[model samples]
Each structure stands twice: as C-alpha cells, then as structure tokens.
Target: MVHHTMTTNSTSASRASSRISSMSRFLVLAAIVGMLAACGSVPLPPMEVAPPRPAAAAGTPTAPDDGAPLPGPIVQGRSRWQPVRWSELPGFDTDETYEAWNAWLKSCERAPAPFAALCPEVRRLSLASPQEQRAWMMQRLQPYRVEPLNGPAEGLLTGYYEPMLEASRRPTASQNVPLYRPPATLGSRRPWYTRQEIDTLPEARAALRGREIAYVADPLDALVLQIQGSGRVRIAEPDGSVRTVRLAFAGSNDQPYRSVGGWLLQQGLLRDASWPGIKAWAVQNPQRVNEMLWSNPRTVFFREEPLSEFDASFGPRGAQGVPLTPGRSIAVDKDSIPYGTPVWLVSQGPVTSLQRLVLAQDTGSAITGAVRADYFAGWGPEAGELAGRLKQPLRLWVLWPK
Candidate 1:
C-alpha cells in the first residue's frame, strides 16, 4: 500500500499514509473547503493604510496582561486595539518565543528593508533566555487589544490539516480514480473542462489522460485534492517501493468555485455543514456523488514534487512564500494586515480559546474583512479537525515594531 501525506491550506492539502475510510475520504473535502474555499485566485486589496498609531509614551508602554482593564480601545475600520502593556498579551510572557522564531525567520527571508532589518534581533534572541525574549519583545513590539467592528470583541477560529491518501502510480481496477497535472494549454484556455466535464465527457477525459500524475482508490480524495489546491499522493512504483509525492497547485479552471456544503445547507439536505453531516448525507445518496462533485464547476490542477525531509514537517509555502509554522501562522486578508506583521489574537470558541501572538504570514480568498483570519492549525488529522470546526468569534491586534 502506498500512503502519501499531503499538507494543504486555502491553496493546499495533504494525504495520509494509509487509505482513509469511506467517511475519512469525504472529511478531507469538508475540511479543505471549510478552511480555504480554494482561495488561490483571490487576492485581497493591498493594506496601504497610513502609518500605525504612534507608540505609547516610552516608559508607559501599555501591554497589560489578561484581565487588566484596557484603556479606551483604538478602533480601526473593522477592528480595534485596546492600549495595553506587553504584559497584557495573555500568554506572551510564557510563549516559546523561540518556537515562533523559526516562522519569523522564514518571514524575514522574504521581508523587505524596514522589517528585514529586525531579523538580527529575532535570531539573537533565540539564544537568549525566555525572560530575555520577553524583555526584547516588550522593548521592540507593542501589543493592542482586539475588539470587534461593532459589538463585542469576539471572533471565530477554525483549523485545517494535511491528509494522507493511498494511491498507485498507475491506474488499476481498484485504483480507478486519477489526479491530473495541468494541461500544456491550460493557460491559453480561458475556462478549462469543469468538474463535471472532466469526469464525464470523453473529450475532456481524453484531454487529461496522458497528464495523470497518480491514481487514488477513493474519488473523494481526488476531489479534496482539487478543492484544497494541493495534496500528497502515495505512489507505488513497479519496484515494490512506496514513495510519497506532493501534488502542489498548478492552476485552476477559471470558473467560480461553488461550495457543495453550502449547496446542501441551502437545499436543506443537511442541517449541519460539518464533515460528519456532509458524510452522512453522502452515505444515503451515493449515486449523487457526481452531482455533488459537479456542483462547483471550478476544477483545480496540480504539479507533482517529491517531499524532502524538511518539507515533510512544515506546511506548503503560504501566500508570503514562507513555510507555515502551524500554531504561529495565520492567513489574513492583506488589506487589513500586511504579510509578516505580528499579531496578538484572542478568540474563545466552542472548540478552542486562545489569547496569544500569531503572525500574519499568509492570505486566502475567503479570509477577507478587516478582522477575519484563517489560522494554520499545523498538520495531520488533528489540525484538519480543528480547522474544519473553527468558525468562531475572532479579534486581532497588530504587534507593530514600537
């Protein structure tokens, strides 16, 4: 058995080393769409805001720890900041700042002049004590409160993870499903064959035939791969060896993406949009799988890459072109938060509650609005589960260099 683990975001996904169960197969779809909605082509407006609020009086740097009453909140469009001392960032003093330093370093790799210069301190502090790290942050960074645009300061949190799928290098009786690479003419063609056309039309099938990268046993795996934009396929070579390869996003058919879960929700087919609910519906209506697949005309294509040891640990490169750092990484609408900017996030949701610092390292199509974000929950089933379920009240404060 060939098992390939793939990591995905709004623009990526992954597969497990073992074949997922009937329900597990569909969960990948629910998780990816639930998190990203395939936000590859979507780009947010640039965050060309005026310079940030000047820092608090030097010695009076307000960053109180949690529970300390905040001064009047500073409202910014859809978000607001409560002036607080760095001590107010909940777990700031306790966070493994060095753990997030890697992500920071990765961001610095692409960060420009003003921000890039701060890399030295990030690297230097890795060797410093945690107390020293906290001090360094307090000296260099300013914390703010995350308030809502109108009502209470609350927001949702969701999660996504890399999935692993079993596959064969060549299609066979059981491994009938196929994942294809971008056709040479994909770019020249405006809107390529859609989900339905690609599945049924002989012409469409013929066009993509030779482009097959790998074949999976479950059709849902293939569908999830496309929706998430990238994933891993476990390939069984003729030599009796299993090698895992990533199906990174190449491009997509220009058609607008429609949500199958949303469709079922609107049609009243399923009361809940959770993966379990979607899977339950699928079990009763196996014959309508194609109908569901074709619900969204947009189809994605992939390009294969062999995962190196380092690449296996981190997620696929995000919008900022840096590898995601699990809990420390988040995808935000660039219009509200610039990439590489540090942020203090606070959210209390049914699944999780967090009041900590996270970086705006990525962006997604569905991640719009001034206060919206898609958190990178790390890898595997655990991350996918969290990301899939996270759609809760969220609030964020920019951690600008003071």
Candidate 2:
C-alpha cells in the first residue's frame, strides 16, 4: 500500500511541473503580443521559433553566415515576404552600410508603425561601427525576400531625380511655359484638365489664372520638372534679384499619366527613347514639339518652398513626408512594401550595378507592381543623367524587426 502511494505522488509532481512550464510559455507570449500591440504592429500569428543556423568557419568564405530566420512567409497586400537568411542577400557584407545609415535615420523621423519602436536604438547606433550595426541587425531583424504573390521575384528598377533649372518668378518673352499651383476646383473634380486642355482651353486656363508659381524657358524643361515631381529652380524675381527655390509637388490633375518616352517608342520616331534622345528629336522636329508635349495628359502642380542651407543639404520630402537621401531613397509600390521599411535592393546592368540598402520612403504613379522600384538619384546634371538612363532588372528584400 505504501509503495502504491509513493508512485501516485511521483506522477502528480510530474504533472504539476508540466503545467508550470506551459504557463510560463503562455506568459512570455502574452508579453510579446502586448509589446507589439503597443507599438502599432499588426497582430502576429502564432509563431514557432526556429533553431539558429550553424556558424560558419572563421576565415572560410565558402560557408554561409549564421542567421535567425523567421518561421514562415508574411503575406502583404500585393506581395509575399518569404523569410531568408542574412547570407542569402548578395553583396550583403560588401556594401558600405554606413552610407545607408543616414537614410535610415531620415526614415525614423516618420517611421512606419512597425518600426517606430526601434528608432531609439537606430539613433544610438548612428555612431556605432558598421560591424556592430550589422550584428545588431542580424540579432534584432529578420530579412524577407520580397516577391510577387503570383509571379517570380525578378522586377524592374527605374530611376528618378530632382532637376535644377533656371526660371522667372513671372512670365517672360523667353520663359513662356508656366508651372502652376493646384487649381481651386481640384478637390471637387474627379478628373481635372489634361495637359493639352490646360494649355488651350480658356475655361481650364481661367481656373489656373492666378496659380502660376514660376515660368521656365523651355517647354520641355517644364515637362521634365513636372515629371520629376520636384526640382530646384533659380528664379529671377521682378526686382531683378535671383533666389533658388524648391518647387515641391503640390497636387496633380487626376488624369492618368502617359509616358512621353513610351509614346516616342511606340511611334518608332527614334531608337533611343531616353530624355537625351527625346531632346535630340525635339531639336530636329521643333515644329512637332507641341504634338509631343500633348501626348501625356497628366499635369503635376507645384508649390514653391525657400531653399535654406539646411534644406538644400537633403533632397525634397518624399511621400512618407521625410526628406529623401540621395542614392539611399527609393519609390516603391505602397501595396507591396510599406513606407519606412528598410529594403535590400540589388540590380546590375550597363547603366549601373547596385547592391545596397535603401529605404521605401516614397512612391510614384509609375511605381506599381509587387517588385518594381524607382531609385532616387538626387539632384543635378549627373543625377539627371543617371536617372534618365537607368532601367534594369531588380531584386528586393525587406528587413523586419524580430
């Protein structure tokens, strides 16, 4: 009888211990959910922690680096983010990560809800060594391969930049092409005037009568400025004074954007359809310049902002409402990737080869689809030249806080 009693006690103790262990795990998971909820994170699904990858041999480049991979793919609006190893990223270690840090900091200014919690640590690591920063990233973040929901990972990478142009505060004989502010009726109208209508229709012109911000000499320059969304203009005031100002995207006519370059390509006017090629065609066919300009129905409006010394240091504010960093900012499909997400971008071609970190801090009308991106090339002639020529295949990976 005594022996039977002792056996029962042993079994009861084991059951009690098992209960305690289960409760501990529950409490830990509850705490995590609370933290995520407080930081405005999407409610996480039940997660299983995977084993960390084995460490590579020191000095052996053949072996892959160790990483803590997430359990499964994260489904987004227009894309799927499959968890990947840090080592899977091509040129992950080769990039000068410090160069991208400045852009990351800018993103923290208006950080996405998921990343807002990490801004403090991000700032702290501003002065940290690249190795230290990299280590922290591997420890605290999960890298996800950004892929289309229905197709392959490969996509397109184009380029854009801020144009610098000379302008007059008011209309001049030479500077006839005018850039305007948003029309008063912009909100009430679902689709506003087309580019040609605004130029020719008296009613449309009357709506934008007092909205002119500045005028430029070349009609093509005005179109380029509108296409870029923002630019720096050295304006000659009525007082014969000159001041450099930033013309920021205020609003746009709701008409769909039609690419002039694409139109030229369709017409088979010239083989090369880059901005330079378009200008060459314009020079040759000056009589048909208006015909070329009217091809794209969309018209973007702008508001002038004073370019202070501090403001001039960075590019204009992107869609995320933060000043974009040259070469580190990218315009992404918001449905595919959220603003303020740290993205690993890789592309290679004759124009350039890029494998580095960039932020999804902006979006463009043309930047649609799951894998597509528009690389922000900053401002000036060199930037414009690069922007005009870059169109290549791209791959992307996004980093999420662990």
Candidate 3:
C-alpha cells in the first residue's frame, strides 16, 4: 500500500503536492483517450442548457453570509427575488435515494478531484444496502449543512467539458466535450455581461459593497488534478490583432461532463471514498496528502502563488499560469449559491484582475444555504498564493444565469 504521508507546517503546501499527484493520473488518462482516437479525430456534441424552474416560497432558508436577514425577493434589478421552496429545487420531491444521488452528482460536478477520490467509498456504501446508503449519505451531508426543505425555485444547472485552447496548431484527437452550454452562446459566438446590469441589482450591489465573502476553503486534500488528455482542437479568434488564434480541444468520453467523480473513477486514479471518505481524508491528511499529490508529475494543481515567486519560476511562460477568459466567470443563483461557482472574482490578491476566477465553484459537502459558495483557485504553487492573499471582499452577479 502507498503510505501517503508527509510533514509540513503549511497546509497549502501539502495540498499542492496531492494536486500534482492526481494531475499526473489525469494526464495519463487523457493520453489514453488520444491514443484510442482514429486519425486523431473525436467529434463532440453541441452544448445544451437546462430550463430554469419557477421560484417558490417555503420556510426561510439560512443566509450564506453572516446570519443576516434573508435578502428581499428582489434579485436582479429587473426581477423580484422570489423565494424558492425546497420542493422546487432539484431533489426536494425525490425519494431519499434520489436525493442522495443528486447530491453526489452535484458534489462530483463541483470538485471532480476530491469527488473522484471519494467515488469508491460512495459505491461501497450504496452497494451495501438501501439503509446503509441512506446512512452513508446522511453522514456525508452533515458537513454541507444540507437538510430537507420545502419550496420552489428556478435556475439552471449547467455542465460541460471545457477544453483548453492551445496557442498553435489544431490537434486531431479525443478531448472532453461540454455536456451543456446555454443556447445563446452555442456555435462560434462570444458571450458578454454588463457591469451596468450588475450594478443595478440590490443583492448584487450589496454583495459587492460588503466585505469579501469568506467561503469554506477547499481542503487541500480534496483537490484533484484535471489532466488534459488528447483530443480535437477548436480555435477561437486570437487575442489582440494577432494572426494566430487560440485553439480549444476536447476528448471523447460518453459520460456526461457532470459526472466528474465517475469520470475519475473510470480512469482508475481514485478509489470510491464517498462523502465520508472525502471528509475524513481531508480532515486527517490536509497537509501530508497535499504535499504528496503536488509533488507528483501527472497532476496540475490549482492554487495561487505569489506574483514574485511565479515570475521567478515560470516567468513569461507563467501568463498561462492562471486560466482566464474575458467576460467569463462562474455564475449561480443568489438563492442556491452553488459550491464551486467559477467567478471572475474581482478583488485584489495573488490574482488581481485578468481572466482568473479560481474560488467560485462549490463541492456538495460544502455547499449550503442560498448564498453559500466555495471558490476553486486552480492548482499548485500559484493557487496557494491566491488562497492566502484572498482577504478582500467581493460581490458577484451572474451574467449568464440570468
């Protein structure tokens, strides 16, 4: 058995190591996908978006921020923030089993690495028996502070395989394809969000003006590597009048992008640890496991590193250090501030401006309340810096979720 242990005073350093290790496995899987493709061609389907449900009212939900009174029903400047009854959200009416599965899927989508690592445990619990699965799920759900509720709400749950567009030359190979994309941005179209619109909404404005929201930091041990295997390269127009355009790639995996944990398990890098396993592992090995994983070559960790340090190491090559897209930030409904909601996160820290949106997405175990959330700062040294210096306050308004 692999004795995954290390001694480190810095929690962040340990996490970086674990992330690096997992990334190595992810990359290997990607390579396998590339090798299997014929003539290096893998076709992907167009992105799809789920329709938003109507908002309903039920008992008052807990506030994500400090125990402040729930925000008024006014959401964006244009629409009233109707309360969403628990019944209206995704698993309210479902049986306990379905609810458990839904939570698992949501958690997997939020943080593929940790969720993937926990997959084996989830499977074991689910396989043990119905009662066992329920018990297991309940134990898992405790950390997230999730509970049954009654109400109706409306919002979209989107999933997709985002391919990194390379700097040069399109590759003919397999790559992960996005499972969903809102109809508006499908095809070669640019997406946009307006500052004016964001400014007008009371919730958005209040969130912006208030002190930076301090989310539950993603435990370093829970971090997993997202390896870019081989696939087709799709290019978008290049930045700044340059003749060369940026290219994006995708791999062929029939599984839905939302099943991130399943994807990792199928690749065999992570065991099914389930929710309890994940929580336990995180709590126990926060520092040691992180260091081991980060030291591994197959992984690429997401974290913030000091600018000076980053500059000294990667230098000019470091521009690609943090993945950012113009006008692109993770968005979520104020009511269900999903864990891991990727956001441009406009505040000063290791990443001030640029296309970085590290700490927005939420892992299910961590996601609770209408406005609660967790941000994913990429991986490795860079991610560490951002995570440490992340003391500024920020308010976020979703551009597309609207």
Number of the top-ranking candidate, with lDDT as the measure: 2
State each model's C-alpha RMSD to the native: 8.9, 19.7, 23.8
Highest TM-score scorer:
2
Show the lowest summed lDDT stretch of 10 residues, model 2: 16-25
Pairs that clash in candidate 2: none
| Best-first order by TM-score | 2, 1, 3
Mind giving the per-residue lDDT tens digits that candidate 1 earns over 381-400?
Answer: 66666666565566667876
lDDT of each: 0.61, 0.69, 0.25
lDDT string, candidate 2, 1-402, tens digits: 000000011111100000000000012111111110000101212222334444433432232344433569999889999998887777776677788899999989888889999999899989876666666777678889888898555687766667788899898899978999889988887789898898899999999999988899888777667656778899999999999998887777767655565566567785545445566788999988888879878777777889999898888887787888889988888899998999988887667989898998877654667787777777887776666556567888899987
Arrange candidates, best lDDT first.
Answer: 2, 1, 3
Error of 3 at 263 (Å): 31
Better of 1 and 3 by TM-score: 1
TM-score of 1: 0.78
Name the 10 consecutive residues with the lowest summed lDDT in model 3. Answer: 16-25
State the lDDT of candidate 3 residue by residue for 310-375, as single tens digits. Answer: 322211110111222112222223234333222222232233432122223212221223332223
